[model samples]
Target chain A: MAILLDGKKTASELNETTRKRILKLKQCGIVPGLAVVIVGEDQASQRYVRNKHKLALKLGMNSVIKEVPASITEAQLLALITELNQDTTIQAILVQDPLPKHINEQRIMQSISSTKDVDGFTAVNVGQLYLNLTGNYPVACTPKGIMTLLEKYDIFLRGKKAVVIGRSAIVGKPMAALLVNAGASVSILHRYTTEIAEYTRDADLIISATGVLRLLGAEAVKPGAVIVDVGQNLDETGHLVGDVDFNAVKDKVAAITPVPGGVGPMTIATLMQQTVDLTEWGLANGK
Target chain B: MAILLDGKKTASELNETTRKRILKLKQCGIVPGLAVVIVGEDQASQRYVRNKHKLALKLGMNSVIKEVPASITEAQLLALITELNQDTTIQAILVQDPLPKHINEQRIMQSISSTKDVDGFTAVNVGQLYLNLTGNYPVACTPKGIMTLLEKYDIFLRGKKAVVIGRSAIVGKPMAALLVNAGASVSILHRYTTEIAEYTRDADLIISATGVLRLLGAEAVKPGAVIVDVGQNLDETGHLVGDVDFNAVKDKVAAITPVPGGVGPMTIATLMQQTVDLTEWGLANGK
Candidate 1:
């Protein structure tokens, strides 16, 4: 059997490191702060926001949740974002996904100040990552977290054949950028891909964020390929699963990140870690 | 022999459309303006700027050339850009590349306002393109022009396998993004790419931007593949050529863009077109 990537354990270690960084900031009378803006009472979004809030407080940092109605006008949302952009205490800002249909989501997302853009959804930050600019900038949490996990396992990325399945702004796009910057020959596949297996079977590393259950199995992937499943889907039995068929491909792959204990945990850990980083970067730049 | 992707003819047709757009703007008492900023007395840079300036004037639009010395500091350059940003008459701005070692090139490039970024090198514009976000925003000229050229040839992008060699900020990266956005599976190969042919041979469409001479010949490419060569290099005879071995592969490929008449002409034409686009967009948005 292949070795489990052990995201849960790695996330805990990362969170531990974040905690120490928070303590250092506290010593300097600087407290890192994160504000999550949720437009509606989405059950999933609510739960995710609550977890981030609780974790921030546990790590001894200030956290704020801005919960508004789904009927909030785009202009009203923009005003709220502008206020947060100028708020000195808020070092990191995230607007919860699945925003109301009435709101211009991209506009609202891009409105966040680049310094406090915790999720790195803004075009400026995304551009920086795409350009491989030489400077400190935030990246999409899930992908950046995956990079950390891969580094922990000593997976060589340079010149490696990698396949990223999906083209999402928050996950797949940024994931490919990170891999490409690492000197990996990265292919980005999406819904229009005629043969996913054609690329995946030759890849040394495969990242799937398609949210399609059982999207990949042993036959679809190369032997000894490292697999990262970013999907959070419900199987036929309603069990939370990833994009890949773990039981089928686990033995064939060299290493794999599991569904629940994989990318999910690392995302939150990286968010917290980045919150502290933004705080330190702000202090260093006298923001 | 393969059909040539005649960029010179296509560019002229595009220039005609741009001229009409300029006429429309002029009828509304608005002169679309472009400013090309050149630092130092680099002959090549000066010539390119002059071509842009001349094109803007030929299309009956206002064109300005800002020539500065090589000794100018980063602060001075930024200040100059700020001046152009506030200049209501200047609709599009381009800063010549290969800037002095002392100046931070990306910083100066990104400093241009997104609306006035004629070259579309600004991170915001790049981000928009990468995100595939809707609405009118400029893109890097060379790749955007290549898209136009491909469209003219009626090349199908959806579900196609595309190999974009190189990952430069202005050409390769944006070209890949455009191809991916159009639903093609894109693999970006760089110098670290192990076996370039492993992907190129399988690609239905190949866009090579790496400035390497005689990179691809008939043997390296697939039969009937649509090839777009963005490299403009010199052969042993000092004749201007492209990344592809045109003479060898021209008879084997379905279509190809000739070096001198290919991507080169379309780039300037696209810049002229986008200047008018930015101008009209500015007028509509009251910028």
Candidate 2:
């Protein structure tokens, strides 16, 4: 059976590190601050935001949640983002995903200054990350979290064959970049790939983020392979599941991340880390 | 036999388009300007600089050639780059490759502002290119040139399997990103790649930039595949050659690029086009 990648434990350790860093910065008269803007009451978004708020405060960082109703106009949202962008006290600004249908998410994202783009979703940061340039500000949180977990587990990426299932802008794309940085020969298999089995079966490491339950079976994984499941899919009973067929592939893999406790905690962990990093950066650079 | 991808004729046609654009911009009181800095008088570097100078003039852009001694210190070279970076009249900057061993290439490259980073060697540009984020900046010229050639031939890259047999920062890495942007599944093979022939033989498009002569034979390529050879290795007899055994693979491939007449010309063509593009962009946004 595969060794389960304990993201819950890893995330707790990361929080410990972040907590120390936050305390150190405060002694220097620096207060790490994160501004989160949520439009509309997405129950999931609210819960995620509250969790972040609680975690940020626990870590000794100031957390401010800006709640705008669903009736808010795109212009008003832009104004809020701009206000945060120019606010020196707020080191990082995160606009929650799935804005109202009338609000343009990309437009709102573009409005945030790159320096304060803690989410790392701005074009400048994304572009920098893609080019392997030096100013690769914070990368998108989930992919960064995935990389952090891989490092914590001592997973060897150099010269390994990595197959990333899915080509989403957030997870798969940045994941490939991080893998490539670690000297892995990476291949991205999207909906257009026909020979995914051929690629996945030979991979030393496989990252699945298709958000589809049981998208990969035991036959698609090699024995003793490292598998990272970033999928968050709903099963028939409305329970959350991952992309890998866990039970079928468990014995074949050397290590794997379980759905509920694996990558999930790391996502929030990365966000918190980035928020702390941004706050420190802002204090130093006066962003 | 593989049909040769004619980079020479294709590049001339592209220059014409660029020249027309430059002329239109000039009519509106805008002239595309390029500042090229050449360190040392290496034959290859000299030849490349000459070609760029000639092409810039042909495209109606102001071209400035700054030749520095090979023994110049890194600080001296950086001083020259800083001037060009801040010069409003200079829209694009190309620093000839193979700088002195004592100079750190990455530091020198970072000195070039992204706006004037026509070579696209900066980490930020590479990151953006990898992410497929189209910023208001010039892409790495060589890969841009190759993409233009592929499009000119009406080769649809969507859903195609591409094999890039090199992983150099300049050519192979950016080339793979370009192929991915066009919707192709790219497998990048390097020296460490085991069983590279298996992947190369199955690819719909094969691009070799390893500079090892005759690396790809007829048996190594799929019949009717499009082969692009970016290698420019010289034989012991001083003859320029590519990575593929042209004679052996010529009969099987649908299209291929000849060694000297292929990617070489396109590189300069793209450089010239970028020079003009930078000038136009500066005119419109230089304020």
Candidate 3:
């Protein structure tokens, strides 16, 4: 049986460290703050926002949630973002996904200040991340969290063959960038991939974020490969599952992350950690 | 024998198209303009800038060359970029690479407006290209030129296995992005990559930009794979050579790009094309 990469426990440990950092910042007369703006009444978005707010407050940071109507115009939303951009108190800004049908998501994302773009969706941040630019820039949360997990587990990535099974802007893309920066030979496979097994069979590490349940199985993965499943899918019984057929692959793989308790918690933890990091960075830069 | 992907002929065709577009823009009282900035006395850089200026003028466009001293500070260079950014007549900006050791290249790159970043080295432009954002944004010249070459040869990329050697921001990185955006399963190899042949042996399309002489030979590549050589290296005999051993692999591959007349001419052609594109986009947006 494979050792489970316990994301929940790791997240808890990270949250404790974040709490200490927040306290230190407070001692230095800096209060870390995050502003989360959500347009429309997406239940999932609301739940996510609420959870983030709770975590921020728990860590003794300032958290503000801005709720706008579903009928909000793109111009108005952009104006709001501009307002938050100039607000010195807010170190990080996050706009929840799935805005109304009429609004251009990319435009809204681009409007956010790169300095305060904690979600790391802005073109400037994404580009810096892709190019491995050295400096203070927030990485996309999930990938950052995944990297932390890998580091905590002492998984050395240098010279390793890593296969990332998605090409999403949020998870797979940044995950590949992070892996490549860490000196790993990375291959990105997506829906257009004709034979994913050709790449995965030789991979030392596999990260799947395709949102397709049970997409990776025991037969497809090499023995002793380390798996990190970033997928969140609903099974026929409405139970959350990962891309890996965990039970079938557990005995064959060296390590793996579970669905609900794995990448999910680490993402939240990284968000909280980055929020504090932004505040410290802003303070140091005299912003 | 494999068919040679004649980049010289294709680049000429593209230049002809660009020249016609410039005429149409001239009819509309809008002259496409480009500002080339070179900060040092590098001989190769001088040659490249001269080539670009010649092409822009040949296509009947306004071209301005700014030659600054090698000792110019980062701030002064940035101010020059700012001046060019505000110059209404200059629709595109190009900064010759390998700036002085004292100046930070990325900072100067970021100072240029995204709208005028014809080189597409700015983080905003690079990010947009990585994410495959829609609308009008100039792509990195060499990669964009390579794509045009592929299209001219009617080489479809969807579902193809493409391997990009080297990870330089100018060529290899953007090449991977362009391939991934075109629905190719892309793998990026760098200095840390162990056993590069393990990936190259299965690639349907191989793009080598490592600047290493004869890096990709017949022994490393599979039979009938398409090759695109982006390397420019001086051989022991003082002749420019590509990373591929053309004499060794030409008979085995279905198609390949020659070094001198291949990616080189296409790059200059694409720069001219993008200059016209920027002018047209600016006119449409009333900039």
Kindly list the per-residue Cα lDDT of model 2 for residues A1-287, writing each as its tens digit: 78899999999999999999988988988887889999999998999899988998998898899999999999999989989888877888989888899987777887888887887877667766765666438888888988889899899887788888877667887787777767787887777777778888988999998877788899999999999999988888998889998999999999999988899899889888988877776666755
Give the per-residue Cα lDDT of candidate 1 at A125: 90
- Cα deviation of B126, candidate 3, in Å: 1.1
Candidate 2 is scored at a TM of 0.94
lDDT winner, 2 or 3:
3
Better of 1 and 3 by DockQ: 1
Worst 10 residues of 3 chain B by lDDT: B123-132
Segments in model 3 whose C-alpha atoms lie over 4 Å from true places: A28-30, A39-43, A68-76, A79-83, A86-89
- Say which docking band candidate 2 falls in: acceptable
Instruction: Evaluate model 1 with DockQ and give the value.
Output: 0.80
RMSD of each: 1.9, 2.3, 2.2
Deviation (Å) of B202 in candidate 1? 0.7
- Predicted candidate 1 versus true structure: per-residue lDDT over A1-287, tens digit per residue: 88899999999999989999999889989999999999889998999999999999989999999999999999999999999999999999999999988887898988899999998988889999998888888999999999999999999999999999999899989999999999999999999997999999999999999989899988998889999999999998989999999999989999999999999999999999999989999988988
In model 3, pairs of residues that clash are none
lDDT by residue for model 2 (B206-264), tens: 88988888898989998889999998898779999999988898999999989889998
TM-score of chain B of each: 0.98, 0.95, 0.98
